[model samples]
Target: MYQAIVSPQEDKFIAVRAGQQAAMQLPSAFYAELADLTDSDGVVPDWFGDAARQAWGIELADLPIRDVLMVRAPSVLPVTYSRASWEINKGCNFSCEHCYLEQRPFAGLPLPEKLRLLDMLRDMGVIWFEITGGEPLIDQDFVPAYQRAYAAGMMMEILTNGSRLYRDELLQTFVVNPPHKITVSMYGASPETADALTQTRGAFKSAYRGMVAAAGVGLPVEVTLIITKHNVEELGEMRAIVRDLGLPFKEYGSISPTYTGKGTTLATQVPGLIGKSEVFQGCPAGHTSFHVDPNGFATMCKVGRDNPISLIAESPQGLMRLPAIADAQMLRTGGCSGCKLSATCRVCRPMARVYQEAKAPLNHYCQHGMKEEP
Candidate 1:
């Protein structure tokens, strides 16, 4: 006997395992046809034989199968869970010249407020939650919030400047219940570069120590380098540091030209970083993830928080309205449509603001747009 099942796209032939061949009473022709179809030179891959046996408990040799072609409709909703970021605090201990979170002061959400929001998120089936701030650890309520979120079954991630994660207690907590991942922004090559970028003398040392501490606790760490005019030429050095530390790092070509923090003098001193052509463009915010400001307002991306789509409220009804807001913004002129590189671009809202302010064409960053091929 032969059994056939239809998948969403094609037909699948199932066969009985070796010992069950006699028990199943399958015909000899069934086994021969299956063998012919699944032979080494046959259309199906050899691995499929094993897969069919495991899935259907039938040997490919005993199952005769045919795959019928079918047209499949595109899925309406995306498959994976959408990610949402929450700005737990706006204040940072180190003020980097290119800091996008420059508008707000450093502070953690109140304990009561944080708990309420976590509960709401849990009820909404939010699996990915990122806790960020000037330095999220700076907030006294940080550890409790992490514990609560973990208990609620949320896979948490933290984005930090990495200066305050060196405490032994914090390191142990991270090891005990590590977030899905932690991103530490590596400022520069040496103490001077780190200090110059952060405007804090000991920040680089602290951040390096934090990375080592996190590693000791067996937590996975990813390093991020914000490439700017000052650091653009040091990509090789940065890569070496990542290799030496045995950590993963990504270089985000500088997306912001205006420094939002206190060190306006240093911010103005650095020249143009990457040109517009170098930035990959598609706004994947609504498609994959989104950012929520400290005040609970939803923004398309984390960089630009001034324009909000909706507020994160206590009720589920309010949260449901977010997609429409994202859709509306996405259709607008300056949101994701202006750039020629929009299809491949990782353009964020903050970068959009810079282009709007300068009244520059899609290529806001001159170097990326104008550089000659090496």
Candidate 2:
């Protein structure tokens, strides 16, 4: 039986997946007719959102049409990803003390290999590509890798440190075919403080020059501030610096210590500024988005970079099954069990791995809600 459901945003018919069966596009008239027959409760039912493909054993031709707007169809929803972050390389020119990669090697697949990986992502229907790295622009293969993504009609978001963007060659390449947007991380307000934080000479100047050059070239630019003790005192001034740049600005206060799940390197940050309950809200990792490390292992996000499924081994065929893959990796554990903070908790499988050794999941990972040592 055809059950009609209207789109929450508009008076449009909701799309239904026929699954392995024939594809079905329930017409608007179907919904209107169904509404006339069924009891109308003005509110849109919760099941409306969960609706997907029609169930098995129900022959499409034989089933009679029902005149109810909200027909109970067993939702066999398919998982489709709209955005993906590709950590092209783990290499960076500068050695920022708090780098989540924790000074991991600057290694990655060669240009030809990376392009093949990009092909897999494109075929799998990833609409948005967030090209990130230890610092993407500095990588030797970045230009070619980016060129391939642009050619594929993917909306590309570049995450860079702004160290190399000032060069005329790099600037020209970007101008030739610009990205959707470039997000630059603002380390410090002054050259001395910034260089000190980056632990490299002339880093602040180079990064600043590159950021400004991108803006001058008319490429969309965005700056984000990483709140660390090294630069926390100058937060006001840092915001002012980005403000003068006349571009969008964002602030990130949380610092995850271990870049990879292997080591216990602390990427320290400001104390008690952000509360635990305030921070551990629901995460969209498996739900709406996911990330890929330099090695092509896909995970829900960088925070929990473990149990990454190999993109190389699985694509188009297996990659199309990400919804099931993500659902199976659903993040929940005894650590969060019985805690009042569970309702709004964003702690997931990756984070659980982060503090697995410490055995104090919430206190170790969360900036707030510090519990005393046992």
Candidate 3:
């Protein structure tokens, strides 16, 4: 794999080849994208943007120039996936209030079918799998699915609320085979609060016990907290708890509305989050990253829920054609075309229905001037 290390301080770009910094510089073609990337303040410091513009003939001369663009590998890289995430089933033991997934019947793939899908994923060039679910441990065929993927030479990860990891077979399987990481979600800092949040009595103790037990076996473990009003003040304490468990790292994310694509839980969102005003990138679906439901339907992301890229419907040859299909479907059209703030706008048509109060393309949560396009 070739790696181009770009320095924000200077135009110094070097490509790493064969584990060494190859004498080759980033080919001149990547400069403009690189510059626009660094100048997120909407300010291009130097002629890098210009060089990129002239080289690439960027029509949005309105966009930027001579900058050294970073040619990032797409999610669908030749030999590896940027990422792949899936929920084997919606069956979870601990029910949390902020959960995006509502339960469907336990209709996940069977073990043989799962192995077939795993083989298909390997064929499709997925390098790793982030296997998550209502609780992946609750899924009957999870271990077989995981082991199959691993045997097929793919890296694997599991996301759980941590209730069932302490099981001997699971603990040993992970200790011996090991995953890239096992990320556990901590609902709250204390037993009462955590259990209260999950609506499952004793779930907090079970989760912590699983974390401790997994770490005791030397498996890589991480804990993440989804910031919500209920646990907002307990962030530091949660970090401390994870630290006490001696997990490798901790992370946090903002609470999102229920993910059934209905935005039914939109009212539960914590507005106090200090969010960034970052601009839009391209559609993540059907491209760099993809999500597979238990049913083998694929999409660029779990959110859009629009175009269904049915994995079972496609042959291996058909799967290769997906990137183009994804790229074509990723465009923003109509009112989204000429909007200057399109870069910063968060609302898209799919989630627009979630925040369906306003029928316009504007983001209903906009504290900025995004409501009305000038």
Per-candidate alpha-carbon RMSD to the true structure: 12.5, 12.3, 13.0
Per-residue lDDT tens digits for candidate 1, residues 217-314, read: 66768899867665666668878877788887887654454433223333433344445334544455654566766666666566544446544453
TM-score of each: 0.67, 0.71, 0.70
**133-177, model 2: which lDDT tens digit per residue?**
888887888888888876654556888889999988778877775
Model 3 residue runs over 4 Å out of place are 1-82, 274-280, 333-337, 346-374
Candidate 2 deviant stretches above 4 angstroms? 1-80, 261-267, 276-281, 320-325, 346-349, 356-374
Ten-residue stretch with the least lDDT total in model 1: 68-77
Q: Please, what is the whole-model Cα lDDT of each candidate in the order they appear?
A: 0.59, 0.64, 0.61
Highest lDDT: which candidate? 2
Off by over 4 Å in 1: 1-81, 232-235, 257-273, 276-288, 304-314, 332-354, 358-362, 365-374
Better of 1 and 2 by lDDT: 2
Candidate 1: count of backbone clashes, pairs at least 3 residues apart or interchain: 22
Candidate 1 structure lDDT: 0.59
Q: Model 3, 1-374: lDDT tens per residue?
A: 11122321112343221112123345445544554554563433344334434543433233332232223322232323345788788788887787877554567777776777777676555654789887888888888787776654445678998899899989977765557678889888888888877889999889988988998888778788766667777888988888887775555544445555445444445554523334445465566567788888776566655556666666334445556656654565544455565556665544434434323223333424333334
Candidate 2 displacement at residue 133 in angstroms? 0.7
- How many pairs of residues collide in model 3? 24
